[model samples]
Target: MSVDEVAALSLTEVAHKIAAKELSAVEVTEASLQRIERHNEALNCIANVNAEDALAQAQKADERLAKGGPVGPLHGVPLAHKDMYYRAGRVSACGSKIRADYVPDITSTALKKLDAAGALEVARLQMVEFATGPTGHNEMAGTPRNPWNTDHITGGSSSGSGSAVAGRMVYGALGSDTGGSIRIPAYCNGLVGMKATYGRVSRYGAMPLSFSLDHVGPLCRTVRDCAVFTQVIAGNDPDDPTTSREPVGDYLADIEGGVSGLRLGVPTNHFFDDVDDEVREAIQESISIYEKLGAEIVEVEVPGIKHGFALGEVLGRVEAATYHSTWLRERPEDYGTQTRNRLMQGFYYPGTRYIEALNLRGQLLSGFTDEVFSVADILIAPSVPMAVPTIADTDISANQGFLDMIARFGSCTRPFNFLGLPALGVPCGFTGNGLPTGYQIVGRSFDEATLFRAARAFERETGCTENAPVL
Candidate 1:
């Protein structure tokens, strides 16, 4: 197959073909590498391309398969991930000057799991410096451009993951979400991105943005791709005690089961109050499709949703600030203006207020799930409420209204991170600006299977997964 042809296959498709011996792992890896080389210059999404190492790994995969031994499910699938995930003896820049050459002595458990599953890592994609910004504005490491519209933002922290996956440089990527990092990028790039329930995946060797709010998940070309990827990485980790002990569900087993009897809730408040007409129209159209698919649409008021966002803001910033306090005091100049200024505010927040914010999370989550889930199986809301903004328009790090822009971009996503619920961003349709926008299906904690099923149902009906940016 040609480079673009091979690179364009979905993660599941590529994996199946490789397992069937219809395609060689080396050929697949080379095709993906060629796409990265062709587009990385314009997209600025890749931090480091592991061409030689990936090829070597792919060759090994082919040899193993030829030997007719039992093979892992993801054998020979080529993937990339955000620069933040660590591999021992390798530089995990974390998209910052502070860690520009920082090499870790331990590999992230997430990477180790993927390695065991036989997936090859093709590259380290760029991200917001230290995963601070919501928009993909990294003055230190160059910002990634949205493949759909290069002038627009790819939505950040996982900016490069969005760009790389959507640009077809790689089939799937691992992205971390502190406050909508994964979902916003998924929304902006027209991909399926999941921020699984808090503690669903380990965070042992990944860069820390907010210890409490951070989540590890996958960004992929399709919902099933996200499902299989999530399965590989989900579960308890001895290295990270925070990982959940809950039995991981078979995400792909019932993904195509459809949403025939499901109740999908639409929030009547904060989620839609600021949404653009184009985005709102797209979401409504998606709801109509769900109704046709036999999903009963219910309008429900999310209890304390606004307060949840406020508390999350307090907790996330304070946690991030605490982590970077030493560097803020000593190597302040090494950080970008936005990241530095953002982290500085954490230090100023009163300890009592921080404690209160931490205390309120459980109360808020219980109240939210009790009220929201009683009426709906999963809540459907805009992943990003506004029409996608241009990079120049949102490049407000030095501007006075930087916080407002960040808040606007994260208005729909941050609250869930605080609530620690699983949310999936699936492409519904595009706004008038020619950029993609999507809705997130927020499920009960650790109920990622339901989220995947609903998302897959919509994906099948709308054929949304078939759409890709014409890079």
Candidate 2:
């Protein structure tokens, strides 16, 4: 295959090729780096391109493989990540001016796991300021333009991860989701992104947004790829006490198990409240496909999600303000205007409400899961409520309507974050306006395998994923 073709290969394809020695780690790394150089200016999906370091790592991988050592599953596959994941000595901007020159002294457990698995990280992707926004806008670092249509938003926090993966500059990217950061971009850019059950992955060495809500996950082109990446980076971490001690299942093993006979829930309440015709139709089409595949669709009264977004907003803002209290107080001028405006709201919230929200989480998770999962193995809903909005339309910095638009954009996703359930964003179809949209498959806590099985079944039947955004 040509260099561009090599660069465009998905994560599993790249891993298989490199593992078989049909392609060298150097070749894959170089191909991705070349793609990044050619396309990054327009996409701006990456913040710091680690050309020299990546190539050196690639060379080392080649030497190790040549010596016939046990190979890492990701050996030599080049990947990029949102700027929030810290790597010792590498700049992790977190898409904020305050951290513009900050470099962490330690690497995130997730990155270390990926590194041990032989994934070569090629770049640090862009993000919203302190990962505070839902839209891919960062006035301090500039918003990353959508690869499919540069005029649109790439979705936020995980903005660059979506852009880079969709643009075919990287195999996959690490992204954090507190309030839809991972899924929003996955929906907008047409990729697969999963916010694993909270505490499923370690948060050690990663930047904090909301200590209670932040989750780390991947954005990839397919369900299998999402499963593959998640496998390597998931499970217990001594550094992170919040991490689940439950053994990491082989996500790929049962992925092809398909969704046959599984009960999929469609919430009759909150999920579809503001869903547009196009959004509703695409997801319905996916549901119809699943129905034909023998998956049972059950409509259920799934309550509590209605309160999830607002509760998450309160917790996130309060925790964020607390985390950045020093920064917000000391370097108030460092944050983007929109981020500052948003973060400052945390300060005004009553501490009693924050505690009440925190205390209510377990009851909420219990009630919601008991009701929904009791009737369904998985829950399916639209990832984005409306058609993917243009960057200008969602730009809170420029538009007056964005205040309402932001909440609506995250309406479906925020609840999962609050509930700490595993949710995957699967690209099902494109909107009439030519932008991308998808359905979210939320699984029971620690049951990401079900989410993958269901999504992979849909993907196989529909062939929804697209490569090489029309940049």
Best by TM-score: 1
Error of 1 at 52 (Å): 0.9
Cα TM-score per model: 0.99, 0.98
lDDT of each: 0.92, 0.89
* Model 2 lDDT tens row, 210-322: 99999999999988899999999999999999998988888988889987799989889988988899889888889999999989999999877777778888899899999
Off by over 4 Å in 1: none
Collision pairs in model 1: none
Pairs with steric clashes in candidate 2: none
User: Which whole-number lDDT from 0 to 100 does residue 107 have in model 1?
Assistant: 97
Best lDDT among the predictions, by candidate number? 1
Stretches of candidate 2 above 4 Å error? Answer: 398-400
Supply the global lDDT for candidate 2.
0.89
